[model samples]
Target: MKEKLSRKLAQNVEALKDIFQDSSDLVYRDIQFTESRRGLIVYVEGIINVDLVDQNIISPLIEGLVKAEKPVERLSELPFTRISLTQTSTASDWPGVIEAILTAHVVIFMDDSDEVLTFDVKGGSRRSVQEPSTETVIRGPREGFTESLRINTALLRFKLKTEKLKMKPLIVGKITKTDVVVSYIDGLAKQDLVDSVLDRLKQIDMDGILESGYVEEWIEDNPYSPFPQMQYSERPDTIAAQLLEGKVAIFVDGTPFVLVAPVTLWQLLQSSEDYYERYFVTNFIRWIRLFFLLVALMLPGLYIAVTTYHQDMLPSSLILSIATAREAIPFPAIIEALIMEVSFEALQEAGIRLPKTIGQAVSILGALVIGQAAVQAGIVSAPIVIVVSMTGIASFTLPRFNLATTVRMLRFLIMILAALFGLFGIVVGTVWILVHLTQLKSFGVPYLLGVSPYRLRDFKDIFVRVPMWKMSQRPNSSSETNRNRIGAPKLRGRADEHEGW
Candidate 1:
């Protein structure tokens, strides 16, 4: 069987050779021993660590006793070799060789044996774990996950430090063979949720999955929706908290962002820093964030409605001021607002795409020049410009860029609706949004848990974050069991101590 397998492998090698013909980095070597035995070693150059292979396998086997007439006998007798050597009874084959080489493992074959010896030599260039620039916190650990799968998994292990923490590996993407790990706490997490996540992942049959975002889009319940169904974070502490609460985390190789399932709309408004701060301060900040969120999504639409259809909504003094500002403008209220919004978005995109040294200055200069030029030329009203500016500022208060973009896109839709039917259209749009959100599910959990369904047990950490001591249980929506996170403290008075004395 070993001999037959080796012959088959040899035939497949010609096919693999043709497949990798244009590749300058692929290394192939055909070895012939003194006894007329045949074999081959194939690997990609830079991806595989050459030094370790040379020291561990190649140097000893080729330069030492294995280089002689009875190389197979010599290798079998060698006691100092660290590798678990095997003998193949079949012929060394091509597909097996290609698979092993691509994985950064060294494959060795010998004449008259069917088994191929595979040595693990995975060391190569990889980025070191560093602080996450996008999700920085002053009080927590600065270290963030690297692109390497092993390193990312190690970071999680360091935080969890328990056997209950489970990481199930999956191979996604038919061509890319990208590795994805689904992590969760076993006992704390619901079994059905885990099974659902796994089932969804298995259903994905894409050609490639380069990042967690791809998986998120593929497995999401509502792909057409503007809102993000999965929450992404580079912070391990954030992931740890979610995992403890029974939310499954998906870590894709080669990307820093990790995807957490069953996230609520309110969760997108939260920051990891909220838990680190005092309860009262955190609650105030949460409310402030919620206010900004509404302003970001609705300010432009509200302005359009009031200026075009609901002029009576404004006070007499404010109405006069608005009228004076618009008198010199050449365009209608809708066009004026749209122009400013589009210009602001263009400036933002330019700032991001430009070089860091000049981007900030360019954005600032662009905003100043455009605003001043528009005011002087009477192309747009001064009050409209102010509203757009305030709206831009409010959008920045959102922590997640994906969610910010969602708000920006939806703001325009609301604006159109408001223009058509006034405040009634705005209310109708709001109802549509809420209906979609209420129907959406992240994994198997409702997206509007604590607010829509009104679960009192989960309220402590949602809209208004309570102190750490007061939050004695994990989020109820996240886990069906193991909700307790802290134990109750027994009070001891001074009188009780005196009586004991």
Candidate 2:
């Protein structure tokens, strides 16, 4: 329980001093409203707007009281218009007052009154909007989410202007007391999914929620699963698009990455640029990415398996070339593949860890110089180097970093299985992965949505990027009630006729 503000000024001052004893940033000032009426103002030094507090709060109260023919009985009862700031509210207890002050609001205390007035002067330094570093696109909105939570929400609001869009505020951490916002279209989002997400968040009683990833780990359907059940993006257009499809977006203060839940594998693979560009171009790109996705996951393991246990599968010319390359090398196919894969992964990590200029140089040279040296020294075969380099390049095409990382990890695991049982091992591992995916759920939606327990309608935007004219319904993974996103006919108009607005 918190102590209530006293009717006496000196007592309240002593209590405030005890509470903010060692805090040097707390600013407390006493002002005389009239010859008889006294008051105090409290705020933090850097956070609160000093000029606004002075002009709207202090100057008006002192000047208005002096100009009045009769003195006011209490500060709260003051009849002057500019005496206190607009959007001002009263706090009767110390906790409320302190909370207001901590959140960058200015608090005014009257000597004879038991209530304190809090003015919303939350002006401090913050980052301006800039282009996203992670999720880049050529033809969509260039603006991205900043570290500021309010700015991020403002970016979303700028894209979507509708009363149906609702943001429910939540406080997650006990010590950090970080602000979290759950945003979704009120009618489109399923009530049960929203309720489950809120309940999971409320149950998180921890010291801190430093990043949105923290909440993500806790609320995700399967913590141990390598697959990313929830998708995170720094683009407002992405988040806005998800909200329109009835997905809930979770925004954590101090992190630019926002978490979008009830995500499917198809959603993870798709990019915002797909919707922004021409349909044919996007479709072609999607096919290319899909092909590379397979190469990233299966290329290394398949090479090892076929060369080791099923060499007859390859053509005679290719076999002769692979045999000639391995003639000088001592290591088997599995060991050769493992050596190249590990070296490539190390170079990738080094590139990310080093400084920007040097990192790029190192990642490029590290692969070229190291691979060439290894091949010439006969420590590894040339074919293995080519396979590993192609696998690395293919992994880069994945849109989401988390998904790409998952592919890298699973690639190694499948490689090991292939080393043990050859072609059978690859089949076994693939079956196990498929079984796990079929069993997995993100929130309540299936992980392999549109493919497993398949929804045919949801495939409009999946592997093949269908034209927007044909995509009239929202994704089924959202469990949306009103699914008709576009109301007109599938075809826009005839080739020769231009439809008039």
Candidate 3:
């Protein structure tokens, strides 16, 4: 059952006051066009554009600009141009009126009328577009997504100007009524993948959604998995690139981090700078990233296993020096490594939470001070300190924060395994991780998409990136149809090709 609006303006005002009892921010302004006709304008203070409402809606009505044959038609015959508004319509139900006021829409009540007119005036202060701090690139667009959903979608539209680029909207929370957009290219994206994401979004029923992480947790395929199933970024250029590769982006209101789906382990490791720079430069950097990725995940564990189980593997001089350093130490190799790792993790977390001006200096000075003091006191060996420092540096090289956290967590488990069974335990952990990765799927797509499946086409961008001229086709990340991106690719341009276009 629904309550209908009354024709009497006085009764309607009373009803509205009752509906919004004890709310001091709710405003109700009385308007008198002439002697017999009366009206009421309703809105929430501060959220809407007061000037626009006054200049466009209220000013025209109070003045003699509007013309109507009868009192009933006077409310509908306002002569003014609408700016940044949706289709104006008459709403008759109390529920619609309440919803309109809550969403920054202005409602008008007229005497001797069965309905009222509502106008969309959603506006407020929001952060402007700026450089993304999380995924910074040496070369790329500096503009990033804002907290506004419409503004975020508009940013994407500015990058990709095509009718085929569709952004379908969904309201997730019942109470908050947060807006969400699912953006994708029609031909490039698989229809099934879009439907899969939409279905998951539709099934979400919650009281409120404050951030994109809420939606992410509810919709991800494996909630218990340590690795993030979807990649989130604040850079519009990143989201645009992902869409061009046929991935769907989820844009949540009040959040700048838009999430991209069907991501892989390699994708998390690769930075946006890779695509911006030359093939040779990016390829070398990616190789370095991979090398450090391995070091970050296993350096401490390997050191512990070697010292505890197989000291003969190291050179005579290195083994003798390490043994001399550890002679005065009280803790075992594993304990020493664990202590250093925990201290480093705490410093890293504290540095992030502290103010920016002193955070970096604090982290650096704290690590140096603590490491030197511990070494001098014989609380830990010097070799383990170097190993932990290198591991921390390596973890920072990873592009994705979530993936780096995963590596940090796995490092401890690997250290425990090494302590128990030496190198064999590390090998067992490696095998277990590989099996789990092969089995993990992101929205029905394999976590190790091209690596496990061995796609020859994806290798161009995976291990080593070929020249852009050779990359005429899209990677294995997208659908099979329309795989080719460019018509032809040439290795070199002729000397005569230097003429201006």
Candidate 4:
């Protein structure tokens, strides 16, 4: 049997030489039986831990007390010193042996033995935990999720510290075999929602999944829509809070940003830090953000409409000032607005792409140079530059970049509409956008939750941040089984006791 198996392996080798041609790490060792007992160890070089394999499996089987006169008996006892064996496999042919070896385990074959012993020896390089750059907060924890799947899950586990936090592993890409984990509180999350997420993930059959963004693109409901259906965050506290609210969270192996499903448009504007601060302060910030969101989306369009067609709408003094600023400009209000908006966007993009040492300098210098040069050349008016600058500042007030970019893009469309039909066109465009938003869903929940659908219960956390004591329940859209977060407060003393005192 041994001789026949070896001959078959030689034949297989002859056929597969081309397939393994450029693989320098592939090892094939041939050994002969002697008084010392000889065998071969085949594995990929860097993937397997060399020291552990040598000290635990290889050294013991070759030079220790388990060295048998018969090779097959010795191979069975080799796993005693190795602590990490989840399973063991015995292969009869070379193809089976090669398959086992490539699956992140070391393969050991002995002379005159038809069986091959495979040792679990998976070890590779990975990054350590560090502060998340994108989601940093002065008052919160500094630890962030890393690219490794195991590390990311461990981060969540460290936060939750409960048995109910369940992680379900999934393999998405056919070629990359990328590992993605869906995590949620078992009893807290909705059953149908979990099933739906799993069903969508299983339907994906792609060649590679490099990042969480790839999974987002594949599983989202409407691929053509500019708005993102799923929310991504680097903060574990944000993910933990969502899980507690009965939402499913997806963590891709090689990305810091974890995806949270069934999120609303209003939820995107909120930051986790909002809930951590005083109610009054948080409410003030929320209102500011809401105001700026509208300003970011409508300022340019409104400016164009007023200057071009609705000049009568402005007060006489204001109109005189704007006219004076525009007297030397050569372009129409629409063209000037477009040029300034596009230039600001370009400067913002350059600031992001450039290195940290140079990014701030480039952004400031570029803005100053462009704004001054445009005004001096009479290509764009000074008032339009001020409006564009205010618009850019307002857009940054939004917490989520996905929503911010959507607002920015729609600004241009609204600008065009305003140029054609004045303020009426802007109103029409706004109504159309509101209609689309009302129809949109994140998972099955409406995007415009508390406002459009008029859920009075959810308003506690919406437009204004209510005090923690007042917030007694989770969002209704979460569909959480354990809905009540807090119980009614009890009075400290009885009325009779107070009267006696």
- The predicted structure with the larger TM-score, 1 or 2, is 2
User: Tens digits of per-residue lDDT for model 2 on 1-501?
Assistant: 247889888888889888889999999888876677788889999877788888887777777777877776665666448655567888989888888888788888877888888888866677789999888887888898988898899999999999988999998888788889999998788888899999999989899999999999999999999999999999999999998888999999989999998999889899999998889999999999999999999999999998888889999999999999999899988889988998999999999999998998999999999999999999999899999999999999999999999999999988998989998999999999999999999998998888887787887778887878888888875555688888777556577575563
Per-candidate clash tally:
19, 0, 0, 0
lDDT of 3 by residue, 138-232 (tens): 89888889898888999999999999999999989999998899999988888889999999999999999999999999999999998889999
lDDT of 4 by residue, 5-120 (tens): 44233444453354467888877665434555556667887667778877776555456434554443445654355344556677766567656666567876665556677877
The TM-score ranking, best first, is 3, 2, 1, 4
Q: Any idea what lDDT model 2 has?
A: 0.88
List runs of model 2 lying over 4 Å from the truth.
65-72, 78-80, 83-86, 496-501
Q: Which residue pairs clash within candidate 2? A: none
Model 1 scores a C-alpha lDDT of: 0.79
Off by over 4 Å in 4: 1-19, 25-74, 82-104, 107-122, 487-501
- Higher-lDDT candidate among 2 and 4? 2
Estimate the overall C-alpha local distance difference test score of candidate 3.
0.88
What's the lDDT for all of these models? 0.79, 0.88, 0.88, 0.81
Output the better candidate (1/3) by TM-score: 3
Instruction: Give the Cα error of residue 259 in candidate 4, in Å.
Output: 0.7
